[model samples]
Target: MAGIQFTDSAQTYLADLLSKQNTDGIGIRVFITQPGTPYAETCIAYCKPGEEKEDDQKLQLEQILVWLDGISVPFLDDALVDYATDRMGGQLTIKAPNAKVPMVNEDSPLNERINYLLQTEINPGLASHGGDVKLVDVVEGGIAILQFGGGCQGCGMVDVTLKEGIEKTMIARIPEITGVRDVTDHTVKENAYY
Candidate 1:
């Protein structure tokens, strides 16, 4: 909240847009989709009264009320919302420096730490093969269960990829994880790389 900034022109433009919506309690909601990954995207959408999530941080601006997505707040640090005009017209621009940067630390939760590593390390390598993995849950005894998607789902080389690549990387980086397990039903090989 402290780091997000809205320029005067941007606020006025947004307020005008909201007013045109004609909804009594319409406002703008700011969120980052696919936060903490290369695909992270900062978005602003019209949010009518009840459209806001219960956990959202309601930030009241001078003439507009903004609901900030709680999960995306960290990634929105130092975010900027501005409006620029040219000969053609004016366009609103959003700049979020940390959107695609994984934020994690030793004190962070186990699942968060695992996901951060997956996003920052594992996913990039998997992207080359059109595949990726997601942390499903941390079961008892520190077993980090995961679900693979895309080309890795039914890839014949998934076993080697798991044991040699993913498992080794996760274990070496996160000591709390006793092991990694795949929960994906790989029987459907529609997108399998191999």
Candidate 2:
């Protein structure tokens, strides 16, 4: 959560959401994934049914603000939580403006390559046990986000697969790929292969 900042718009959105709840208490829950998850999701909730009350709402907001003051705003700064309605259904979408986007390195031709080596090369080897590999993103610092799926979700061999297998193979084949990082949040999912 270092170097995180919240834009003024994000703060405003949060405040408005609190006001609309019409509950006695409200507070936002913020948590970061452990790494290697499909997507990063955040949730905000109003006071529990039995706990609703005017004082509760005030206290909740106060607590959240206090917590925000202590943390790096920019870490959570660019996040936007919006409510939308459509034919599919009404839902909340949490968008992170500063989320890392993959970049193509210009200096090295290898860097510029958008090859799905993992999909073609790595996945086949893992498919036997219903396992899969997902490429999350290529970060600015030459780090890549990877997610494990299927049998590999909570498999004890994840680290081994990541280090000796994935990392070694990727680095050997693509010299520009400096490092691989798993940004999976294991706690959110039950029975992970790793």
| For model 1, the run of ten residues with the poorest summed lDDT | 1-10
Error in Å for residue 98 of model 2: 36
Q: Please state the error at residue 19 of candidate 1 in Å.
A: 0.9
Count of clashes, each model: 0, 28
Candidate lDDT scores, in order, read: 0.90, 0.54
Model 1: per-residue lDDT, tens digit, 12-119?
A: 999999999999989999999998877999999999989999879988989889999999998988999999889999999999977997788999988889988888
Report the C-alpha lDDT of model 2 over 1-194, residue by residue, as the tens digit.
32333444555566677677776445554433321122534434444345433322122332233133222233345555555657995555666533322222345444324234565467778887678777777888667678887777767777788888888888877766877877655444454543
Model 2: lDDT to the true structure? 0.54
TM-score of 2: 0.39
